[model samples]
Target: MAFVPAPGYQPTYNPTLPYYKPIPGGLRVGMSVYIQGVANEHMKRFFVNFVVGQGPGADVAFHFNPRFDGWDKVVFNSQQDGKWGNEEKKRSMPFRKGAAFELVIMVLPEHYKVVVNGDPFYEFGHRIPVQLVTHLQVDGDLTLQSINFIGGQPAPSPGPMPNPGYPGPGKHNQQPCNLPCMEGAPTFNPPVPYKARLQGGLVARRTIVIKGYVPPSGKSLVINFKVGSSGDVALHINPRLTEGIVVRNSYLNGKWGAEERKSSFNPFAPGQFFDLSIRCGLDRFKVYANGQHLFDFSHRLSNFQGVDTLEIQGDVTLSYVQI
Candidate 1:
């Protein structure tokens, strides 16, 4: 399953190329940060920095610099006051100019574990308390796609994500308790529609994240949140390529409900990765694509607690799903 950042901690959208932004709550332990982008065609180097503040020559906690200059090595370092710290370098590069790549930097208690394209690459031990690092800067040669702040514990090992201890859906108002959604990533594959149990069930603060690619000839991509082993669907999201519309609805028994294709924007592209997130609300669900808000679907199954299984079908290759 793909790593899903917690709601409200998403990245800035299309922030001018060489991006520099504040780490909302600073770099807390147990939080994972993801940077997805492509290297420039004539790229020389790119560096990611975590520092004490945005002050001039601030104390740097971690500096990850990947160089494509002849040596082909990744350099890591830290700085205090305005002076430099010992540098750590490794000779391995997985990034290619003009090709898309996803980089994951997870802040752990003692160090930051970095993963590139789903593989463990390196670890940079902490030179300053992670909690004190308050800014993130990305500069140099690259095409930035996204920067997601996934809040939670570190990866169990170097491979698959461990079972998540996602916070529960406490009754926000007078709403009844909900069936807790499963807390781990679910593996999904194919051209056929499939349904899987949401471990405990669906609840607030719980998120459903989908990472997939729409084909060039894609017609539609649909994902539904429905009742347990039943035909009641509370939310149905279908992004139609041919129609250039996103349809939302609910299904009860065998009947299909009204369609919602009001939005005029098209965020889905053929043959590209789209990070989709569905965050539960007290009376509805807020959907997002590539960290941008898409739409919302109000509760229609009488009780939202019945949404215990997620059904996804249509024309797209699913890469990951976090339920």
Candidate 2:
């Protein structure tokens, strides 16, 4: 299948180093900046900055520097009026020399959540107003592959901008629930054995995002896309922590199909937070965990329109779900 760019954003590819550009729509809560790159083989240091302006003297809202020159560590700080704030450091480094990496900087109400290579890395509290940040600057010993800005409202806006192709309010009535069913408004702390209507059902380019934490005693988690009337599962994603494998399959006509149990790596861990996304394409479903591509499951049930419900169960506590 051909690659599909994320919804509501265009990604930049193979840009020259010392990259500087105004962030499209600026920064806002619920927005994420994704960077894919390879660290230089003989790397010393690299940094990503979200600043108020284009130049060196501009006030920085967030400075993320990973140093490998002496001791390997990541430094987080902010700059105002040419003065840098106190540094917050993490001793362990996630990037490896000469290795490819996927970095996601997710903007939240109180802080920025950084995820590296399908794992939670760190969170840096806001020192400067996120609204003042306008440009993104990346400089260091690395070869950038792509950069994408995804899922956020424009700065100064009161709410999230509607995602492309998603149905708006009153188009379909949602099932009665304790949580709000508004688009982009995350459902927090939902109980396990959870199920929700998928609104307009599945379609190419639509993505479902699930974010949560895995308990230390976690064993397994199951996420299923089901046919409401026929009780068939269009897609079943099961991550078995005990066996250290992720299994994918389908259940149609009351029988389970062949199980796919292969993956390059498992992204889930005991006591770690995870961000999982399943994007529907013309031919298959693309799965990503913590911003890293996991695998694709081809359509076993050809009728995408009939897959209208989402079900989740076992070993995880959900903090957010976006369909």
Candidate 3:
């Protein structure tokens, strides 16, 4: 599920350079700070800081500086009592001059997970309690598009399914009250070839969210809603990048079914981040890419409840998954 902004939280759009503002309610676990912008064409360096206060002498809890100078590296550090801490550097750079980018800083219990353009970039351990860092400071060479605070918990461990067999309507387990849509714990930086059980199996209104980066040379990627016991796929969503097509089909009764290859547009691009969502309906499944509706597939199996597992494979690096 796509994360929802907290109540009364408004996103900042086209904020001026060197933007500094107090974080609403301060930083907390399960909250992610998202920034979308483009690096200046002739950029040299840029920095983002989470500090204790807005004053010049404020302590820095997390300092992210991407240097485009001769070093060509990204630096992470902290400062306290006017003294800077040891610098942590990543040699490879993900940001490009004059290119749009999306960045997410997810606050975890132990560390901050930094995702650059939908790829896991780094994990910076906390140098100060997250609650003490109440201000966000962004400056240097970049054009600000928008900044938003998204609310979501970390992904929960998959629990045992109450009923694994095909059951009639309303026979399957129900989603927990606490885990509302867009409130499921997000799994960060999951490995490829990932498979996770659906706590309540397929049901009307259930949605799955997958966010990831496609490698520059990626050929294809596949997402499957499957029946664990019989190895049958209820829905197979495959994006064949090489062919520039998205094939939708099903695998059942030991045979492949007819394919549906039509779509409004192909949203998958090499070296780009994608937000794909699959929402279950009574008769069909709605597929969306980057928040745009792409296509729909009708149910191929009589018992949609039997699709209890989600399997993802191929050339994609997942940054987040909500199932």
Candidate 1 residue pairs in clash (backbone atoms < 3 Å): 30-152, 180-201, 181-201, 182-198
Weakest 10 consecutive residues of candidate 3 by summed lDDT:
164-173
Tens-place lDDT digits, model 3, residues 49-147: 998877888999999999999879999999999999988999989999988788888889899889887678999999888867777999999988767
Q: Say which prediction, candidate 1 or candidate 3, comes out ahead on lDDT.
A: 3
lDDT of each residue in 121-195, candidate 2, tens digit only: 999999988877878999999998667776554433357533323322222223332222223344545788889
lDDT of 1 by residue, 45-71 (tens): 999999787868898899999999898
Where does candidate 1 have its weakest 10-residue lDDT segment?
Answer: 162-171
Descending-TM-score candidate ranking = 1, 3, 2
- Residue 92 of model 3 has an lDDT of 85
Maximum-TM-score candidate: 1
lDDT of 3 at 255: 97
lDDT of 3 at 76: 96
> Where does candidate 2 stray beyond 4 Å?
1-10, 154-197, 203-303, 309-322
